[model samples]
Each structure stands twice: as structure tokens, then as C-alpha cells.
Target chain A: MTLVDEIKKRSVHVDAAIDELLPVVRPEELYKASRYLVDSGGKRLRPAVLILAAEATGSELKSVLPAAVAVELVHNFTLIHDDIMDKDELRRGKPAVHMIWGEAGAILAGDTLYSKAFEILSKVENEPARILKCMDVLSKTCTEICEGQWLDMDFEKREKVSKAEYIEMVEKKTSVLYAAAAKIGALLGGASDEIAEALSEYGRFIGIGFQMYDDVLDMVTPEEVLGKVRGSDLMEGKHTLIVIDAFEKGVKLDIFGKGEATQEETDEAVRILTECGSIDYVKDLAISYINEGKAKLDALCDCPEKELLLQIADYMISRNY
Target chain B: MTLVDEIKKRSVHVDAAIDELLPVVRPEELYKASRYLVDSGGKRLRPAVLILAAEATGSELKSVLPAAVAVELVHNFTLIHDDIMDKDELRRGKPAVHMIWGEAGAILAGDTLYSKAFEILSKVENEPARILKCMDVLSKTCTEICEGQWLDMDFEKREKVSKAEYIEMVEKKTSVLYAAAAKIGALLGGASDEIAEALSEYGRFIGIGFQMYDDVLDMVTPEEVLGKVRGSDLMEGKHTLIVIDAFEKGVKLDIFGKGEATQEETDEAVRILTECGSIDYVKDLAISYINEGKAKLDALCDCPEKELLLQIADYMISRNY
Candidate 1:
């Protein structure tokens, strides 16, 4: 079975883990707000991926669930605040946390989550050193996430943000968390340094690929499949690689320059994306990252734990949802 | 010189720490917007107090600067996002960070601060056990702060927030941090468990007193002396201790019913408080807490660290700032 399927096979246990982890922030004022976000359903990808990565390294998967839950909590915590910052109205097909709790509640809940994540980290037994190492990674990754958010906001106003710059932004914003997730799983499983390092690298590349594919999907996916509003990035005036590439390829798009992109403008921007072969450009990048991520996983399947990780890579880069 | 004074004496180093912590969130879009808010000048009270508390417990005063700086960074981080959620406009006689950075940048900066604090916390090198204990205190203290903030925001809509409720709120909001600061200092100094416990009590009681005094000052102090606007809590329609006291006393006011405070009725609400003698009532409460804080430090003067603790109590409850 795939990692998701494997996790699903023990869904009751995984569900209980998530349930246990959530009450830490439940009594606070923003309880409903945060719960709205957390319960706003999804596949719980980060936690699942962490487990799979742990299992892929020839370790007992259940042994790393604490780390798994911590990664998931961290991911959701960021989502709670990021949605507020991004002014996103919906998350996981429901009203966003901030939309329900108001911004203050969302913010407090986010803070609560951050502390609670550390609380969970402190609770991990028999692996004090590994726990501290995971915390260090988490702390630095969060810093990089902040840097990425800052750059993202900066890029909105700038005339041009280089493709390399775009890569750096997403790496910090998206990939570092993935890297931390995998590394933490490996650490918890007592994987060798080389194996842990490889898992981290695999996660990082796949994470970037996932984001690149997401940007492309935002530009092309039907509303029925994407669930989020069509052309939401264009509406936000965000310079995704698709738009940046088109802008570079001599597409005279006034929308990204000085004026705002309206519904019609948003559609045209997406259409231009199609005409300039931007989707292909992004797909190529995604594929290269996927290939790199797969290479890192080459040694894993030789062990019994490899199936879950390989499945994770396939599921991550290929999923349309 | 007292520890606060000593810290100011080393303003260059403190300034450097400030500069370093600031960049962790610089890339955040609203960072520039909130930079003015975050950079608003204030007494670096928390860090200075941390340094003193550390020194008072027999820790090498210099050895705790990283922790001191960490405390301050965490404090600022909380303030940045707090103002945004409260939708309050001014901090430190300037615009609130959200008002400057927009809500998103403000939120992101706060996130960065939360993460960067762990970085600073990780820098303490003397005793691993000490470091872990400090982290434990900090993690719990942070959660307490969040809980307190949660209550503070929740109180706005409730008709009856009791005196005990108010105390509980402040305990979470303010006291825990002070307790942790003193405890962390003692840990670094290798103080006896009894001594550390007592010192923590001293800091906690003092912190509670300080916040009560802050509320009283908000009622009585001139706007300029407070370095911000007068009647801010009233204007914001906060369910403060004074307001709660007045509410519980059944002081007849034009406003009633369990609902969030409104800006329109704030002036009238202040008049009601004055008529009901609530200002004096709250002041007495502040004095009682201050006395309790002093009692916690009664035996400490013999240790040479007692003076540091004593002077801090005076500063906490007596100083205009």
C-alpha cells in the first residue's frame, strides 16, 4: 500500500494521535477558530509523509508518531496564520480559521499551536538528543519560512523576481518544512547519518516540486478539482513562476506590472500562461525535482520500508488535488 | 548600577542583539510596515529583568545575556501580533505593527520571533540540564501567555468577568513569564532548588503586581507619561479589572448586557468607573499584590541577590514606566 493507504490502514490510530495532539489549544479563545482549520479536512499529508519516511529507513513506523504529529501540528499552525496573512477565505474546502474566528483568534491559535508543538516535542521520551535536534531543525526551518514570507511580500511590489529567487522563496516557504519532517522521522528511527541526509534531500526536492506543480495547477486546474477560486494567485497579484516566465518571455501583461488582475484579466493571464508554454516550463521544473527526489530514495526500496516512500513521491508530485 | 541600568550601559551590545533579531522577520511583507511598531523604543524591561534575576541567583551576569535577549525578543514578538488581533493602532507612542506592516506581515514577524527565540534559547552553553529546564519553563510560559491572551480577548464580550477571573487572566498573561525568567536565571546560576523556587515566586507575584499597576496607571496617568494615549483600554472597550470590578459592584452604568465593548460608549464608561470609585479599588488590589511580591523576597537580601530582586519589585510596581 501507499503511505497514505498504509496510514489509512491504521487510520484509527492515526486519528487518535491527531485527536490527542489537538486538545492542548482547545480551551483557548480561538479554539473554535483553530479547530475550524484543523478539522477542515485533508489527507494529513505531512504526518503521513513523516511516517512513511521513517518506515522507508528500515525502522518501526509507530516509533516515530510523536515526531510525525509534531510535524503535522507545525504544518497546520503555519497554515492557520498563512491563510490570515494571505487573506485566503477558504482552507481544505471550508471557511478559513481567520474567516471564522476573526484575525485575532486565528493569530492566538497559531501562537498556541507553536507552543503546543514544542510541548509535544518536550514529551518525546528515550530520544532527548534527537528531540532537541529535531527542535533545532524546526526552529531554523520556521525562521526560513518567515524569510520566505517576507520575500514573497517583497516580490509582490518588485518589477521582477528572478526564477532563482522564486526557487529560494518556495524552498524556504514550503520545502524546509518537508525537509524537517523527513529528517525528524529519520532521527526518531535512528537512521544512519547518510540515510537521514538522503531522506531530507529527497523531501526537499519533492516539496519544491509539489509547490511548482501547485502553482501550475492554480493557473490551469478546473475550479471543480482545485476547490479554491480560479486564478487566485493572479488575483492576489502574486508572481508565480508561471507569470514571471511569461513576463520574461516578452508577454506584454499590464496586469502584473502596475494594474490589478480582474476576473477577465485573471482568465487572460492564465490563457497567456497556456500560449507561452508556461505550464510546460513549470512541469519541466517539477519533473526534474521529482527525478532528483526519486534518486535519493533509490536505496530505500532495497529495504522493506521503501514502498511507502516511493508511493509518497508518486502521490505528492502527481496528485491534482 | 542596577541590572536594567547595567543593560542600558551596554546598549551597544543590546542594540546589536536587537538588530540581529529584527532581520529574522525582515523578509516578511508587513515587516517594514510593522518595523516602525516593532522598533518603537521602550525600556527593554523583560531582558534587563531577566539578566538581573539571573544575576541575583548567582549566575554570572554576562552568561545570561543570550537568555535575556531571548526573553526580550519573545516579548516583542507577542506584542507585534497582539496589537493586530486587538486591532489596536498604537504601541510605544507609535503605530501598532499590524497598522504598519498590515496584518500579514505583523503575523509573520511574530511567527519569526517565536521561532528565533528557540534559536536564542539554544545558544546557552553552560549546562545542558539548565538549558532544558529553561526551555521547559519558557515553553509553558509561552502557552500561559497565549491562554491569558485568549481570556483577555474573550472577556470583551462577557458581561461579568470576576476579580478572580481577572487575576487568573493576568497570571497567565504576565506572571508566568516573570516566574520563568527568575527560574531560568536560578538554573543558570546553579542556585539551590529552594532558592530558585522562592525567586520564581518573587518574580511571579511581582509580575502580577506590575500588570495590575499597569492597569491602574492606564486609569490615572497622563497620556504622555504613559508614552501612549490615555483611556486606551476603555477606548478599546476592554474588559479590564477596573471595568470588571465596576461591573461586579453593580455600578449603574448606561451600558449593560453581555456584549463586546463598543468604541462609542467608552467615554461614558470611563465616567461610570470614576463615579463608582473603581479606580481606587483597583489601585488597592495592585498594592496588595505588590506587598505579596515583596513578601516573597523577604529573605533574599542576605544573599546579595536580594537587592536585585528588591530593586526590581520597586521598579515593577512603583516606576511610572
Candidate 2:
């Protein structure tokens, strides 16, 4: 199948897996909280890549579905908790779990999803080794995600952050799990350790590109299309690459903007960022990183799935909406 | 050894184990939040029992300590998350994680402990099977606890709850982990299934007695001693056996003296319970459960450490403060 067709098919498979896998225990708080997050309508991109990557390696058996589904569940679990932490209002164009159910329920719902991820994982019969590996990866990813959040929280209080530091944060926050998605799939298909490592690197690159592009969207998209603030990243004083570059450029240009700008002036500051070509710098950085990611995929020799991996990588960098 | 001395030795052991296990991560959030919970001087009773139970079974080899510590970490994980969900304030004479750090930090901290539990368990180099089984029991126990929380939330919205219904809640909320703890220790020591099952039953009954004693404490200890609520279960209109009996007797006396009291008023109407010997009834009921729990312990024939188990059971019923 073509890359577009592959993603569409994998998306459908993952959606079905989620529908089948989420058991409603009491049909009340546990299930209701789960449904609240599950129905929020995520891209389901991680799981799609999981199943497709597994298939691309060799087999297209139904056995890959559980880990694929678990990835999606893990993704949503992080989102529910992240939304509560970020105090975000809208998810998939509707009220966030916490906003709708209070911080308490949002927390409970996120926890339920966390436990449920294991519940789904523990049930996958074959590939116990792979599942264990995935669990380790997932658990490590969770810890890494927490660390990234701590750094993000700390950024608001600090003055200067380097480009390398920004890359490290995004790699932890975004790329690790994305890397795990493809890596876990390769493990499921009995791929070689070298090949698996390459897939992980591939994910790491795309994850950075994906997050960088998201930052671009924050600055450039219209409010209605974005479903929240345009330049909300700036308003929140997020130390994303664009903002980081803009600040450095601003300093080089004798700009006194170190930190602690008022929220009301966020856009004005972001406007300064665009005027300084800070936005362009961020964009260029994303392209190079994405190209390096594609280069890593190209370096995965003797893998029949290489072309498919390349197509998916191209699509990730180019995606919109 | 006397019960007090046994508890002291076990407390020192588990406390040290917890101390060692917490620093497995370098980032401060995981360790700080862990210390926040552990340093609360929580009596370390659960892990204490786990160690003593393991000792009573045969070996206090270094292997069991991680399992012992893992259970405690799991317990704290549940508490941190549950407190956030329940919006609780003071725990062990200090502000809850959510209260001090806000809901987000508390949630991440709780998740970190869950991760830390596995990390500690993964360190059991002497008996890897025990570690895996311990994790299995813990993961499953956590899942049940989540279900119980859901039911508790559901019961808050319901008008009537039966005694049988309340017992089932106690099983899920309080007893299962105790059961698992004893069974895990025995299994780790290579105890026969029959022995493990019997000890597990011992743990379960003792757990019931422990919770029942707690319920009785709700009636007698007053809020000042507990550092929170005296009759909180009553105030929350929780359908504990105490309030369930109050409902029965209140209905019997047609004591609509207030002409249709709210559940809150009815809960407060436990004064009416005092007049009608309902508190006495509660005390007697708890005593019977303690007796039943002790009887189950007694039925475990031919054990050298039976005295210790029996002593622990006795302590389960009679301890105050």
C-alpha cells in the first residue's frame, strides 16, 4: 500500500483496537473517565506506526494489535495527565477532561488509563519478551516525560536556555515514545538489534520535527483552526526552539528581553521573534533534524520496510491540521 | 519476640530499604515526593508486616526486602493519587502532595512511585521469579483498588448501600493487598500453595479487622486524634456499616424526628445511634470480625512462626494510637 493508504488503514485498525480493548469495569467512574479521554479523538498516529512498522518488518498478523493498542492507551494517558498539568481547556475541540470533570476526576481518569495500559499489555500472550521490552520502554518514556515536564516548568523561571538543551528537552518529551513506537514494532517482528536501534533513532528524529512543527503551528495558525490561542506558546512563555532562538537573537541584537514578559505582551514579543527571523531559524533547524531523521531511516540497510519508513517520515514533517 | 520489638526491628529494616530504594532516580522530583510520603513517619506498618510475615515464613534474606519495599511504594503511590483525586488536605500531619505542589506535581510524583515500585522490584537479583510475581500481584492489586475507588465514588451518589455491599468494598479497598502480601512472602520462600493460601486468608481477615477497627475509631477517637475528621465517614455520608446500621435503626424508630433528614443529617444522627446502642453494635461486630480473623490464623497448623503471626493478628485488633 501507498504511505497515505497505509496510515489510513493503520489508523482504522488502532481505533478498532481501542474500542475493543477498553473494558468498562463498572460502567461508571472507571469506564466513564476512560471514555472521556478515549473519545477525545487523538490522531492515533503512534499506534498506526506501531502496527505498520511491525507489518513492514515481515508479518501482518493480528498479534501486533495489543501492543499497538497499548501504545495508543499510553499516549492518551499522558495526554489526560498532561492536560491537567498544562491546565488546557480544549482537547480535540472539546472541553478537556479536567475542565469538564474537575482536577480530581481528570487525575483519576489519567490514572485509570495508566493502569489500564498495563492491563492491556499483561494480556498480550505471545511476545512476552517484546511486551516486557515495550513495558520497560514505556515506563522509561513515562519517567523521561516527567523529567521533561519538570524542565518545562523550570524554564518559566529561568533566563537562558541553549539550543542543545531545547533539543534534549524535546527529545525526552516527544521523541522517546515516538522512537519506542517503531522500536517496539521491530522487536515484535523479530527484527535485529541493530535494525531496532535504527528504528528508534528514526523515531527520535521525527519526534523532534513533529514537536518543532507544532511550535510553528502555535505561532502561525489561526485561533479557530488551532482550537486555542495562536501564539499560546509565547503567552505561556514556553522555551520552545522558536522562542529560544528569538531570545538569543534578541540579545545579540541588543534586545533586553531576558524573561518575565507579561502575558498580555506575549504576542508582541513573538512578533519581535518573527521580525528577527528567529522563526526562520527554527524552521531551518526542523528541516535539518528531519533530514537527519530520514538519513537514519536510509541508513537502515537490508530492511524491506525502508521505503515505507521513508514515506512515513516525509509525511510526518509535512503534516497539517 | 514481643510484638513491639518485632515491629521495631521490622520498621528499621523496611525504613532502610525504602531509603535505599528511593534514590534509584537522580532527578529530585521522584525522590523528593517519595521522601514526602515516606518521611511522614507513616509507621511503615505495611512493609513492617511484609518483612515480619516473610521472616515468619522462613527467610528474611535480602531478596524479600525489595518486595517489602515495593508494596510500601505502591501504597504511597495509591495514597498520593487518591489524595489528589479525593482533594484531601492533611495526610500524616502534613499537607498532601497536591496541596503543597499543586495537583500536577502530586500526580507526577504518584506516577513516579508506581515506576519506582517496579524499579525496586526489578532489583531482586536473588529470586527473579519472586520479583515478577510480586509485581504481578501489585499490578493486579492496583487495578482492583482503582475499581474500588470508582465504586466509592459511585456510592457517594447512591442513597442506600447494603452490609454485603460494604464488605465487598472493604475486600477491594483494604484486604486484597494484605492477602497478596502474605501470599507473596510465602511464595517467595517456596511455601506450598496450601500454606500460602492460608496465610493469605489470614492477611485478608486481619485486613478486614484492621479496617473495622478504623471504622470504630471513626466513632470513638474524635477528629482531633486522627488529624482529619473524627466521624468523616459519617460526614461524607459514606455507607460504612456504622451508617448503614444507623439507616436501619433510624428507619425502625421512624425517627424522622426532623421530618426527612438529608444523608448528612442522618449521618450526624449517629447520636440517635448512640441512644439506640448502634455504637455498641458496631464494637461487637468488629470484635466478632477480629475473632474470625484470629480463628483463620489459628487454623494454619504446624508453623514455628505461628506465634508471630498470631501476635500480629492480636495487634491488628487491639492497637490504639
Candidate 3:
């Protein structure tokens, strides 16, 4: 089967598991609000990564399904809170949780998801020691994510941010969860620590690549395909790698951080970034990271699941949105 | 030592553990924000309960220090988020975390504490299976706390809340952490399930009493001692047990939900509630709960730690503020 088809098979299981694991019960509105963003679908990429990693390490789908769901819940919890922090009103083409339920409701909903992730994860049927290790990894990843977000917000208020700072922020904000997912999958599948470490490295590199390419997508992808306004990072004054690289090259774009730009102005800015090679620089950097991530998987034995993992890494940079 | 002195001894250890386990690291500002309220002095009652329970179960203070710190972090985490949701300006006689760092900062700070709680709890020196159980209890307790907060907020929007519903809210919002603390202490101390179960019950009952007494204190304690405005709960129209009972007895509170009240108006309302026996009714109920809590400790051997546990239960209802 193609990688997409394989992921779909697993995604269906994850959706079912989420429903069974987290039902709307008492205080129904809070539960509904917590489920709101999770139900509004994305690619379910994080859960796919987790399940694929576990499968590659010889674990069956059923054994790791709860872990997959836990990772996905953590991802959605971060998104709900991030959207509120960023004041973004739309998520997955629907109104954000805060938009519908209000900020207090959104905060509580995110918190519920946060706690439930741990609750479900601790119940995953595994050796107690291995499960404890995974819990450590997941919790540490969460703390790092919060730090990454804090830095991201802090960067917005500054005049300039270093490339190193931008990378650290991305690594914490986006990549660590992916790293945790792969590492956890390997550990739960009973892989040796060495192999688990490699899988974690693989996830870390590709996650960074995925986020870097996302910056490129914002500049180049059509708004309709992108599902949000194009060039939003520039409009919002985000210190993404692309903008940082452009700034380092002494490229001047008047619309940078202007909060809003005309279509023609956005086009002009994109044109300048393209001519200056900032966009290509980020794209090539993303590709290199994906390759590095793929190289780490050489530790695993030759298997179809490993091949699928490689394809997923390539897809990270190759996808349009 | 007096009960106060005994608790003070454990509180000091918890404070030092807090400093060591959650030091100011990179992203100094965020760590500072996370540590702000935690450092601000409160009674440290939850951590004391945890250490005392563990001691009663034949555990040393050093062995369960991390778990004790973990529970304290959870308590402070709830306070930080609850203040933001309730929009309370002050906590523990200082500005709330949200007031100091803004909503986004406060949210991130609380999230950090939450993930750190799990992270620290997982590292506690114990058999993996036992630690995992503690993790389950803590995570489930957190989810219940969210449900409790949601119910508390929901009750504010309605005109009348049943006494049972009010009890449920108080149980979730205030007492579950206490229960978790005691239960975790027992588990880590190698207590049998039966004993741990009893300690959990002990915590649950006293936590309810503690909250009910808190409402009474708000009405009767001097502002200087209470550390906030007197009768603030009445002004804010919180549906505490006292209010629900008074409403049931057909006692009208003109100042209820008024958001502010003159000194004379507040005095008149307190006088009316006291004259109608609602205040006395809640006080008696609180004492009964405390007594019930203390009775649960009868399963323990006649030890000083057990005596201290009994004393702590009495302290739950006896303290003026």
C-alpha cells in the first residue's frame, strides 16, 4: 500500500480510540470544547508518526493506539492554547475554540486535554519501566513546548532575533513532540535504547524540516490551498527562519511586519524574497534536514514500515501545506 | 512540637525541594513567572499532608520530597489558572500571576508547572509500578479539578444551584488535590491498597470541610486576617454551601451578586445569614466532615504521625483563616 493509504488505516483507528478514550460526560460543555479542535480534523500527522514508528519497531497497532491518541491530544491542546495566545480566530478552517467558547472556556478545555493525555498514556499496556520512561519523555517535551512558545511570543516584541534563536524556538515548539512520538513508539515496541535514540533523532530533524518548509509554504502556496492567508508570517512580523535569513542578507522588504499588506504588495515581497534566494535557502535547508532525518533510520532493519517512515519524512518537506 | 510547628517543619523541606527541583533555567523570565506564585507564601498545607501521610505509612521525608513538591506545584498551578478564569486580581495577598505576566504568560506558566509535576513525579525513587499508579492518581485528579472548575463557573451563570451540585463542585475544585496528595504519599510509603484507600477518603472529607470553612471565614474573618476583602464571596455571588443553604431557607441576600457592597450592606447580609442559622449550619457541617476524616485514620497504628494526621484534620476546620 502507498504511505497515504497506510496512514489512513491508522488514522481511522486513532479517531475511534479518541472517541472511546475521551467521551463527553459530566460538565458536558467543557468536554465538548475540549473535543472541538480535536474533531476539526487535520492530517493527524503526529499520531501517524507515532504508530508508524511503533510498527517499524515490530509493535502491533493495537498496543500503541492509546499512546498515539495521547500524543495527538497533546498536540491539539497546544494548538488550542496557541491560537488563544496568538489571537488567531481560525483553526482547521473553523472558528478557534476560544472564538466559540470564550477564553475561559478555551483555557479550561485545553487544560482538560492536557491532563487527559497523561491519564490515557499512563494506562497504556506496557512494562511499567518503559511506560514510566515514555511519561518522562512526554512531560519533558511539554515543558519544552511551553518554553518554545514563550520565546516565540518574546521574539515578536523584539527588533531582531538570531538564526540560532529561531532554530531553538522551532525545535522546542514543533519538533520535540515529533521526537517524543518516535522515541516513545520505539520504546513501547521494545526496541533497544540505541535504536530508540536514533528514532528520536530522526523525528527531531524532520520536524524542524517540516516547520521550515511551513514558512516557505506561507510565502509560496496559494491562499486557497494553504487554508489561511498567504504571507501571514511576514504580515505578523514573525521571526521565522525565512525572514531571519532574508534579514541577514540585507534584503529590504517594506511590507515586513506591516500587519497587513495589499495583494500586490504581498506579491512584490514574495518576488523579492524569491529573487534574493531566501525562499530557496529555506527550502534547501528543509530538504537537507529531511535527508538527515532519513539517514538516522539506517539503524532500523530493512522493512516496509521503515520505508513508510522514510516516505513520511520526505513528505514533510514535499507537501504543499 | 505543636501541630503548627510540625507542619512548618515539613513546609520548609517542601520549599527547599521546590527551589532545587524547579530552578530558574534558560528562558529565565518564563521560569521566574512559573515560580512566582509557588514562591509566594501560602500555608503549604497540601505538601504537609503528603509528607505526613507518607510518614504515617513508614516513609521518610527525603524519600517522598519530590512527590510532595509535585503536589504543591499542582496546587499552585490550579491557583494560577483559576485566578485568571475567575479574574481575581490578588492571590495570597499578592498580585495574581496573570496580573503580573498577562494571560498568555500565566497560561504558559501554569502549563509549565503542570508538565513539571508529572516530570518530577515520574522521577521519584520507587518501584516503577507504584510510581505509575501515583501518576495515574495525579493526572486523574487534575482532570477532575478542571471539571470542578468548569462546574464552578457554570454555577455562576445559573440562578440557583442545588446543595448537592455545590458539594460536587467543591469536591472537585478544592479537595481532589488533597486526596491525591494523601494517596500518593501512602502509595509511595508502601501502604496496602486498603490503607491508601482510607487515606484518600480522609483527604476527601477534610478537603470538603476545608473549603466549607473557607466560606465561613470569608464572612467572619477580619479583612487583615483573611488577607482579602471580607464577604467578597457574597459580593461575587459564589454558590458556596453557605449561600445555597441560605437560599434554601428562604433567606434573601440583597447584596448577593451585586459585585460590590458598602460596609453596612455587607455587615447587614452577614448578620442576616448568621441570625438565620445558615452560617452555623455550614460550620457544624464542616466540623462533621473533619471528624469523619479523622475517623478514617483509625486503621493506622497508634503512632505520632497518625496523631499528627488526626490533628491536621482538625486543623482543616479549626483555623480561622
Choose the strongest candidate by DockQ: 3
Model 3 is docked with a DockQ of: 0.93
Task: Report how far residue B42 has shifted in candidate 3, in Å.
Answer: 1.6
- Per-candidate TM-scores read 0.90, 0.87, 0.99
Question: What are the per-residue Cα lDDT tens digits for candidate 3 across A1-321?
Answer: 878898999999999999999999999999999999999887888889889889989899999999999999999999999998999888867889999999999999999999999999998999999999999999999999999999999999998999999999999999999999999999999999999999999999999999999999999988788878889899999988888988999998888889999999999999999999999999999999999999999999999889989999999988887
- For model 2, residues B171-193, the per-residue Cα lDDT tens digits are 77787777777777777766667
> By the TM-score metric, which is better: model 1 or model 2?
1
Error of 2 at A263 (Å): 14
TM-score, structure 3 vs. true: 0.99
**What do the candidate models score in CA lDDT, each in turn?**
0.74, 0.71, 0.94
Clashes of each: 5, 0, 0
Using DockQ, rank the candidates from best to worst. 3, 1, 2
Residue-wise C-alpha lDDT for candidate 1, range B1-321, written one tens digit per residue = 755666576444555665665562535354454345445666766666666666666676567777776777678887887787777677777777777567777788788878878777867766665676777778778888988888888887776678888899999988888888777877787877887788788778888888988987776666678876556676556677887788778776554432334545645666778889898787777777777877877645465556756766777767775
- Please state the error at residue B73 of candidate 1 in Å: 1.3
Model 3 lDDT, residue A14, Cα: 97
Q: lDDT by residue for model 2 over A1-321, one digit each (tens)?
A: 777776676777767777788866663666777777686667777876676667766647377887787777777877888888887788877888888777767777777777667667556554545556666666677677766766666666677788888888788778888888888887887778887788788888988888888888777776777777666776565778887786676533222333334444655655777788887787777777778888876535555466767767777657664
Q: Candidate order by lDDT, highest to lowest?
A: 3, 1, 2
Off by over 4 Å in 2: A56-61, A127-130, A192-194, A251-271, A298-304, B24-26, B52-60, B126-133, B191-201, B222-225, B251-272, B287-301, B304-306
* Interface alpha-carbon RMSD, every candidate: 1.7, 2.6, 0.4
